[model samples]
Target chain A: MRFLTLVLRSLFRSKRRTFLTVLSLSVSVFLIALLQSLLGTMDALTTSTGSGTRFVVQDKASFTNVIPQAYTNFLRQQPEVERFTVLQWFGGEYKDPKNFFANFGVDPESYLQVYREEANLPSIPLEQVRDFLRDGNGCMVGRALADKFGWKVGDVVPLKSSIFNLTVRLNIRIIFAGLRKSDEMVLAFNIKQLQEAVPWMKGRVGAITVRAKNPADIPRLCERIDHHFANSAQETLSITENAFNLNMMKLLGDYSTMVHSISAAVLVAILIVTANTMAMAIRERTTQISTMRALGFRSGQILSLLMAEGLLLSLLGSGLGIALAMGVASAAAKVAGQIIPWMADFIITPETLLLCVLITLALGLLSTFIPAYRASRRPITEGLRAL
Target chain B: MDDVSVRLRNLAKSYWRGSLEIPVLTGIDLEIPRGGYYALMGPSGSGKTTLLNLIAGIDRPSGGELEVCGHSLNGLNDDELAGWRSRNVGFIFQNYNLVPVLNAYENVELPLLLQDLGRAERRERVLHALSLVNLTDRMRNYPRQLSGGQEQRVAIARAIVHDPELIVADEPTGALDAKNAEEALILLEHLNQELGKTIVLVTHDPKAASHARFQIHLEKGVLDRTVEVHDRPVLPRLLT
Candidate 1:
């Protein structure tokens, strides 16, 4: 504890150098934090608890290809399947191309039953559900989507569909909130209205969501469902909801590998910069180190002091970097939520913070070990003669 | 133990310049009794500083039986020697060698920190040592803020704060002006006589050498002779 002040004072002997090194380190750490958080957010979608019991059945060729709506009857007859719904990606633009959110055409009744845990609408009265089921043009919007467009109950929302080249208008009957922030970025309408309106989409859907009676039955059921449709004209692929979301992320093209590679690169760059800075600082203190040795301070003690300085410098820089990363992550969540609705809950998790701290500590030790050891191990006479 | 602070017999040191072995000290024999004050005077490259460093246990002798404060330095490893030096020897350098980042008090507190002393006890000893050097008022001033003499005095305080049995000073006042040099010499004399410290000083200045009770001269890495100074009177009694 007594040596702390000495180490700190020595570290700042060249204030400009120390400050610049710290600034560079902080910037690198901030970038690493962001990259790691991005990966963590993507991973969250695949690991979500609500996705455990759900399965997605899509065309075996590709998820983009539509599967027959007739497959729903076969899926409902399976004992492992409890309830299921048709979910068609509307791919609709609100007012402008930039104003985009996930708008899905779903069976209003079964959609609510399968996603009850994900979409929290406990406060919604039964009258709204009845109105949504009875009225063919009725729809339900999440609170976030409603707030975004100043939409209220009975407000007619006009959506321009890019896929079908059709304009669909529907009256909102329910403004729902969700158990999680990401869930509130969706707009679900009755698929019957879409089917009646579009001639080609009449007997097909983008995907079918099957809720398994038991989460443990998912693997077997998915395999069974895929085998059932293997010989059909339009073969089907059935996967756990988590795997489905992962496949969706795969469309963004190996982003996990890209983010991790960029993160590793950032770490290596900061390590070199920090190591160089530490080397320069230790070099300048060669004479002082010798004097301390002559004063009966052991080489190990001197080495520890230098290491402590490096560690402290890194921790300080990382602390500021963590704060900056959190602020930027919050802003990014808001902006990214508009473009990628599922990413509305993106955040820098505590696990990433812990991981970053460990990385910083390792970096500190790695960066300082060779230089500090070399400086400490030099003969006392040689060090004394330096300068 | 021969009641001596430092004892050497046939002590020799050499340096290797690439493949060549260059002898610095050869066939040196010396003894300075406990509480004795001695000055080593020699020309440049005469190995006086090298001898001082060896005596302080900061450098190892190439060959010899070297003992300071009753510890045989030859058998001790580097870490053992460091521990022995911390407990038994204090050092003052020509450049004042006080850590530039530390103020006088903190600098004086350095050696004591190597001990098992508590913070309060260390503080008390540091203050007392600074007081002995008459630099207590300047304890908070860093080495850069001090004049040459004041810095040397701070260095002296640092050297004695641990109350080591021996003090090895290499040209203690070499960087000081005449007035400061005289003050430093007086402080050394007081430390040797009043506090019963054994001081081994290496210097080129005749006036600085005059403050010691005896002088040893080194020539070409060999002990030339020893001279006893009769002009000054020893103190009547040890201060403590």
Candidate 2:
């Protein structure tokens, strides 16, 4: 305790320098936590919807490609496919070009039933759905996207399509905010509206998503779906949700490689910064450390005191950074909610928090190893003479 | 009762600066009896500090058997020697050697902290020791805030706080002004006469040496002469 008093006194003697070091540490940790949280939120969005029984049948060339609209009709005949729906990636923007959200042209009935667990689309009364679907351009929007623009049930919103140069006048009859993950500012307009709107709308649809009763039936169902479309002009590539997310991760330039490389850089930088602090503290305390030893404090006490200082500082810095991260993530969720509604689900799991703390302690240990050893093995006389 | 608190026979200390065998204490033979105040006076490089160091267990002898408080100086390890020194010998260096971070009270209480005493007991002992040096009022002041005399008194308080059998002072008054030096010398004499704590002090000032019940002067690593109170009248007599 007395040793800690000594350590604290020495550090606070130059209060500005210590505060600056702590501030630098906080900034470093805050940035690291922010980047990691973004990645974490992305992963959560991907993994939460993963089910082996559900396979997305998209064009082998690209996910955005339109298979013949006739293919969905042909694939419905397959016994292995329990239920299927077309997932159209309707690229559209709301308000200004800066405002972004996913708009998908989907088969509203089958899509809602298939992904009822993940749909953030509001539960419109069957009468309301019929009323909303009464017109071809009538759309059901995500409530989060609705709430973003202060939209209510009767708001007529203008959505401009990026893929097709058509301006969509969507009469928002009902908002379908179902699950937390799928809440976005997307308009699930009638496929007929999409077919009539686009120039290349001749018997074309985006993709078919198939769900089987048994997970074991997925691969055979996929093969069956592909076999049915084998003779068509457009071929199909069927992949499970996990595989789809994995492919998305791969789309970010090899998930394991990039995350590993970036993590290594971050960790190295943290180590260097923390070690520099320890070194400076040790340098200043050369005499006091010797004095402690001369006062019958064991070598272990000196080492423990130095390590404790490093650990305490780092833990506090990291702790504050993480707290700030949660706050920033929540505020960002409101802003990003317009674009990626699922981003609000950025979560810090216990495993992740434990990992963060472990990183802090590890950095503490790693940075202080040399400084503590150097301080401990130092001769009392020489250390005293240094001051 | 055995009066000898320290005994050194044929003690020699040498330093190897690169290639040179620079001998500091050459063949020193000395004895310090318990409860007696003694001063070791010498010029620079005359082995006064070296001999004091060996007696205090701060340094090891290069060649020869030296013993303090019945422990074989050659046999004890560094840690054991430190514990042994803590239990037996208190130290007052030229710079006082008080931990600058601690106030006078904390500094006085340091050595006793090594013991297994409770905080209240430690406080009592520390206060008692400070009272003997007449520094109880200055207990809260840090070393920097205290005058040289008071700092030395606090150092003295720290030394005797644990009630060690012997106190070793190395040029205790060297850094003090004449008044502070004389004040420190009076405290040392009081500690010896009243508390009966054995002190092996090293100094160069004749006035400081005169306060000791025994004075041993060294020249060129050799003990020149041992003088008693009756044999010296060169300075003010504390007893007179």
Candidate 3:
């Protein structure tokens, strides 16, 4: 601790160089944190605890393909099936195409029952749920969705479907909070209204979400449901909701690898930059280091002091970067939530922050080790000659 | 301990550049007794600084026994040599090698940091050393903020702050003006006579050599001559 002032003074000896190096480091660390958190968000998508009892039944060909509504009849007959809802993505624009959010056409009462845990339906007023089930044009919007548009109960919202070439006026009925922030960025209305608008969609649905009577029965129910539609004109694929999300993620093949590669590349680049900066700083102090050696400072002591300077530099840079990542992550999550509702949960978790700290320590030690060791081990007379 | 501050027997030093041996000092035998004032006088490439560095333990000899301040430097490892130096030898360089970032007081406090002294104790010793060099008022000023002479005084304060037994100065007044050089020489005399420190100085200036009681001249890595001066001047004014 007595040598702290010396180390700090040495760091600022080249103020401009130090400032630039720190700025570059902060930016690189910020990028690393953001990319790592993105990977975390993707991982979060496929590992929700509430999804264990819920299964999604989509067309075997592709999620974009619609399956027959007649599949629900078999689901209703199954003793393991507690409730089921038919869901269709209604890709719609509010005031502008840019103001896009997740809007779905669903069987209202059944959808609420299947997603009761996620929607936190126990907290909603019973009257609001009844109002949604009674009114044909009524819709249930997530709390975040309502907040985004400054919506209130009884407010009429008009959504124009880009795919169906029609506009549907929906009365806001129940505003529901969800188990996760990402879940609260959706709006759902009755599939009956969509069928009324386009008669061709009457007996079809994008997918069916089913809740099992017991979590243990989910795997068997999936297998049985898929077997019932085997060799049919409209084949179906039934999977737990988590597996469904995982399959959706697989569509963007090896995305984790890409994110990791980019992150590794950024880290390596920053390491090189920081190493060069430290080498230059140490080189500039060759004579001063020798003077210290001549004053009876051991090689180990010299190495320790230089390493401390490097560590302090790393901590300062990464500290700023982590704070910057947090602020930007919050804002970016909101903007991304408008287009991809699940992305609203994009966050720099404590685990990510801890990983960044470990990286900072490694960067500090690795970048400064070789140069500091060389300088400290250099013969004192040779260094004195540099004077 | 022995009254002899330094003793050398057939001391030799060489450098190698990719297996080609280059001798800097060879077959040197010398001694400077305790509280003795001596100067090493030689032209460039004459090994005066090399011998001083050997005696100061900053460099090791190629082959020979070298002892300074009652410690045999040949057997000591690099770390042990550094430890021995911290407890026994002080050095004043021609370039005034004060750390540019540290002020005069902090620079003087450098050697003390290697010791197990408390903050108050270190502060007291540093202030005393600065006072001895007449730099008490300039203690807070950095090397760049001080004049060349003042910088050298700070270096001298740093050297003596630990109160070592031997003070090895390599052309300490080489970069100073005439008045500053005279003042520095007088200060060296005060340290030798009043403080009873063994002073071994290396210089090319004949006038600087004249201030020492004995002068050892080197020529081509060997001792050429030794002269004793009976009329070494003592400036009482600077001593006060």
Candidate 4:
């Protein structure tokens, strides 16, 4: 503790160099934190416990291929299948193409039953839910979506579908709040209204969501469903909801690898910059180090002092980076929610923070070790004569 | 050996420049009794500073036996020698060598920290040492804030604060003005006589050498001769 002030004072001896090095380090750390948080958010979507008991059945060719509506009848007959819903991705634009949000056409009744945990209907009045279920043109917008567009219970929302090339006008009957902010970025309307209005979407849906009676039965149920559709013309791919989201992520093409690569590069750059800074600082202190040795301070003590200075510099930079990352993440959650609803839950987890801190510590030690050791081991007479 | 603060016999040191060995000191035999004050004087390449470093245990001799305060430095490892030096030898440098970031008190407190002394005892010793050099009022001032003379005084205080048995100085007043140099010399004399610390100083100045009880001159890598001073200057009683 007593040596802390000495270490700190020595670090700031060249204020401009120290400040620039720390700034560069903080920016790199911030970039790393954001990238790690993105990977974490994606992982959360595919591994969430809530998705364990649910299965998604899509056309075997691709998720974009529509599955026949008859698949829902086959799913209902299975004893392990507790409830199911037909979900169609209604890629629609509100007012402008830039104003985008997740809008899905779903069976109003079964959608509520299958996703009761996520939808959280208790927050809304009972009368609004009845109106939403009974009225063919009635739709339920999540609280976040509603707040974003200044939508009220009685407001009529006009959505122009990019896929169907049709415009549908519906009255909002329920404004639902979900357990998570990401869930509250969606808007669900009656699938029947979309089917009746569009000729191509009459007897097909993008996917079917099946809730299992027992989570333990999910694997068996998926295998049975896939087997049933094995020889059919439009074969189905039945997988857990988590695996379905993972498949969707895969369609985006090795993004995890890209993020990981970019993260590694950033770490290397920061390590080089920090190492150079520490080398310069140690080089300048050669004479002082010799004087300390002459005053009976051991080589190990000098090495430790130099290492402490490096560690403090890295930790302070990382701490500031983490704080900046949190603030940016909060703002990004709102902005990204409009473009990618799943990203609304983007957050820097404690584990990610802990991992970053550990990495920073390793970086500190690794960047300064060789230089500090070399400086400490230099000939005392030679160093004393350096000045 | 019991009465000697430093003893050297056939001590030698050499440096390697690629493939060639350039000897700095060779076949040197010397001794200084306890509480003795001596100055080493020579030309630029006389190796007086190198010899001082050897006696201070900061440098190892290439050959022969060297002992300071009764500790044989030949067989000790670097860390072991450091421990021995911490207990027995203090050092004053030409550049004042005080850590620029540390205040006067902290600089003096550094050597004590190497010992098992508690904070109060370290503070007491540092205060006494600073008072001996008459710089107690500048305890909180950093090295940059003090003049060249005052900075050397802080260096002197740092040297004596740990109460080592011997104090080795290399051109201690080389950077100071005439007035400051005289004051530093008087302080060195006080530490030698009053505190009973054996002092070995290396310098090129005749006036500084005249203040020592004896002067040892060195030629190229060898001891030339020794001269004893009969009328060393009497310092002011203020140091008492």
Candidate 5:
């Protein structure tokens, strides 16, 4: 109990310096936790949601290359194919290029039939969906996009295309009838309207989102779909929805590895900076440390004192730093939501909080090691001479 | 060797600078009688502090037989020596080495911590020690808050708190002015006369040396003269 007073008083000797050290450490931890929260987005696209009953038909070569949409009609005639729909990526930006939202072209009625996740749109009137999507220029917007542009049911929005090379005017239809307005990036527009607008886009789509009667028959159904288009002008690639998402992910080229490299670099830099600050603190307290030893504190006690001091300061610093980082992340979330939607939900949880504390402790311990050993081993005579 | 508190046979301490073995206290034999006030006066490098350190068990002799209070110092390990010293020897230095972090009472209570005394018993002992030097009123005063004389008195209180049989003071009055020095000498003399403590004081001041019943002078690394001043009882010795 009495020894703890020694540790506490020692910390207060340099109020400003100690406060700064603790603050820096806290900020560093917050940044790291933010990155960890971002990791929540990593999902095995096709393998995720684990509905092996779903199958896809696309170009095995890549998502950038299209597969024949005529294949979906042929697949529907097959015995194992219960339902199928073509999903197309409409790379369109609204108002300005920076105010972009994910615009995917999918079959209006049949798309809902294949995906139960998007099946609740009927609660909103069909007349409401039609009034907005009446013309070829008219298209429905996702709830995420609707919220972003402040779009109402009757408002018409203009969007420039990156892939099809045209300005697309889409109407704000019934906002996606789901709880996840954040998943608006995944919302779909009318495929027939998109196809009629682009004549050259005939019998072509990015991929097919299919569901088979029996999950075990997915391989057989996929083989049948490929066999019919074998060596044809528009041959098809058949796969599970998970495999389809995996193939899409390959375009990004090992995203997890890249994130890991970035995170590792950040962790190392934080360790070095925090350790340096603790070293300076220990160096400044050389005389006091020696006096403590002469007063009968053993080497281990001195080590504990320094360790406790460093840890406390770093935890405080990094805690403040994390708070700052969280503020920065919150500010960034608004801008990110313009493109990504609901990005603020990516938060630092309690596990992440503990990880931050451990990081501060590790850095503090590593930094205090040399100074504590030096101070603990210093001869009393030499230390007294310094005074 | 009668009434001997310490017995040293050919005590030698050598320092090695690089390849050279420079001997400090070579082939020295000394005996200190129990319950007597004595001063060891010596010039620089005369080994007075070193000799005092050896007798107090603060440092070990390189080649010697050192026996204090019937226990051989040469054979005792560091922990055993520390324990034995706490039980029998108390040390006071020129700087009044009272732990600055602790107050006067706590400073006196330090050595008592090593003893098996409980907190209440330790408190009583510390208070009694503080009252001995008339510093009970200043019990809560830290080293910085107390005067040099008061600090030295607190230090004396600390040394005697454990009731050690022998008290070794190295340059006790070396840092004090004439007035404080006289006052400190009187307190040391009072401990010698009233409590009959065996005191080994190493100092250069003649005034401080005059208070001790026996004074030994050293030059170089050896004792040159031994002077005795009798502070005997007024009445003849009784067979109590």
Candidate 6:
């Protein structure tokens, strides 16, 4: 404890050099935190959905291929299927093409039933649900989506779909709060409105999402649904919600590999830079170190002091860098969430934070060990002779 | 306490450069009794500093017996030597060697930090050391903030702060002006005569050596002469 003052004072001896080193470290650490968090968020997308009971039924050819709404008849026959909804993506823009968000044509009652837990349907007033079920033109907007567009109950929001040559004037019937962050960034309207507006879409939907009566029944239900449509004109593929999201990510190429590669490369670069800085710092203190040795500081003591300084430096930089990353991530989630609903799910989890801290400590020890050890072991007389 | 403060029996030291063995001091035998004030005088490469380092336990003899302050230095390892030095020896260098980042008081308190002392005791000793150097008012001044003479005085205080029995100074006033050098020499003289400290000084200046009771001269790593100064008078103590 008494030696702490000396170690601290030594660090500030060259203020500019120390500040620049810390700044560079902070920037590198910030980048690593953000990148790691991105990977962590993508991982959570597959792992952390509220319940494992939900699965999606899409065309085996590709999820982009539309399937017939008549498949709900077969789904109703299965006792393991509690409820199901026809969902179609309405690729729409509000006013300008830039003001994009996820809007879906869904059977309101069945959607409210199957997604009751995720969308917090029980929390909404009974009147809002009734209005959504009775009016084909009415819609239920998520809390975040309503707040983003300054929408409220009774506000008529118009959306123009680019895929289908039709426009929708949807009356906001309810604003629902969801358990997951991404769930609160969607607007689901009654599919009857889409079917009536676009005649050819009357019996078709992008996908059929089913909620299993029991979680243990999901695998069997998936097999039964796929087998029912095996020889039909449009074959069906049944997968859990998690596998669907994973497939979506796969379309963006091997992002996990690319992200990990970038992170590793950045880590190595920072390690080199930090090690070089530590070496230079120790080199500049050659004489003082010898004087300390002469004053009876043991070699191990000297090494410990230098290691503490290195740890403090790395911790300071990493702490600030992580805080910076959190702030940036929060701001990005809000801004990007308005344009893409999934961006709202972006988060830096506690596990990710712990991993970053561990990396910082490892970096500190690895960067300072060689230089501090060498300096401590140098012959005392040789160092004393240094000017 | 042993009557002899330092004893060397056929001490030899060598430096190795790759496969070459360069001898610095060869078969040197010397001793200084307790409370003796001796100056080592020699020209360049005469190994005066090397001998001083060996006596201070900062360096080891290649093949000889060396002892200081009753401890046989050759038997101790590097860490043990450092512990021995902290307890028995104080060192002053030509450049003062005060850590630039620490203030006068902090610098003086450095050696005491190695000991198991409480904060109050450490502070008391640091203040007393600074006061002895007549720099208590400048205790907060860093080395860079003080003059060369003041810095050397602070270094002197640091060396003596832990109350070691022997002080080894190598050209302690080499960087000082005449007035400052004389003042520093007088301080050393006071430390030897009034405080009963055994002092070993290494210097090239005759005037500095004259302040010591005896001068040991070396030529080419070998002792040439040892002379006792007869004309010098016992100086009055200049520090309280």
- Checking candidate 4 for backbone clashes, the offending pairs are none
- Model 2, B1-240: lDDT tens digits are 577888889988888999988888777788888788889887887888777877877678899899887778798875776678668878786887777768999889888877888889998999898888888898989888998889899988888888888888878898999989888887777777767788888988888788788888888877788888655333333421
Query: A1-387, model 1: which lDDT tens digit per residue?
Result: 978889989888888988998888788889988888888888887877668999999999988898899998888789988999899999888879888888899999999888887777576788987888887888898887788789999999999998878788989998888866778888889998788889988899999999999999999998888999899899999998999999889989999999989989899999999999999899988988998988888999999999999998889888888999999999988888768876788798998889888888898899998999999999988888888
Candidate 5 residues A130-221, lDDT tens each? 65445544455556566666777767777678688866666666566543444454546676656777887766788888888889999887
Candidate 3 local lDDT, A86-134, one digit each (tens): 9999997898998888899999998998888878999999999999999
lDDT (10s digit) by residue, model 5, range B40-144? 988888988878878877667889799887789898865576678778877777878766667898878877766778889999999988888889999988889
- Quote the positional error of residue A196 for candidate 3 in Å: 2.8
Better structure of 4 and 6 per TM-score:
6
Per-residue lDDT of model 2, residues A1-387, tens digit only: 645665665555566766776666666666666667667766765665525567888887888678887777766777777778876776777778877777777776777666655663345567767766576667777767777788877778787877788777877776776556344446677677777767697568887777878889888877877776676777888888768877876777765566657867877887898798789878877876765565556677678877887777778767876787667877877766656656656555555566677777788889988998799778665675575
Report the number of the highest-DockQ candidate: 3
Comparing candidate 2 with candidate 4, which one achieves the higher lDDT? 4
Candidate 1 per-residue lDDT, tens place, B74-187, comes to 999888988998888888888888889899999999998889999999999999998888888999999889999999999999999999999989888888999999888888
Candidate 6: stretches off by over 4 Å = A48-51, A213-224, B233-236
Each prediction's number of clashing residue pairs: 0, 10, 0, 0, 16, 0
Fnat per predicted structure, each in turn: 0.67, 0.16, 0.80, 0.59, 0.00, 0.71
TM-score of each: 0.92, 0.87, 0.95, 0.92, 0.73, 0.96
lDDT of every model, 2 decimals: 0.89, 0.75, 0.91, 0.90, 0.72, 0.88
Residue A59 CA error for candidate 1 (Å)?
3.1
For model 4, the superposed segments whose C-alpha errors exceed 4 Å read A60-62, A121-129, A150-156, A212-240, B16-22
Candidate with the larger DockQ of 3 and 4: 3
Error of 3 at A237 (Å): 2.9
Q: Give the clashing residue pairs of candidate 6, or none.
A: none
Q: Could you give the candidate ranking by DockQ, starting with the highest?
A: 3, 6, 1, 4, 2, 5
How far does residue B164 in candidate 3 sit from its true spot (Å)? Answer: 0.9
Docking class of 3: high
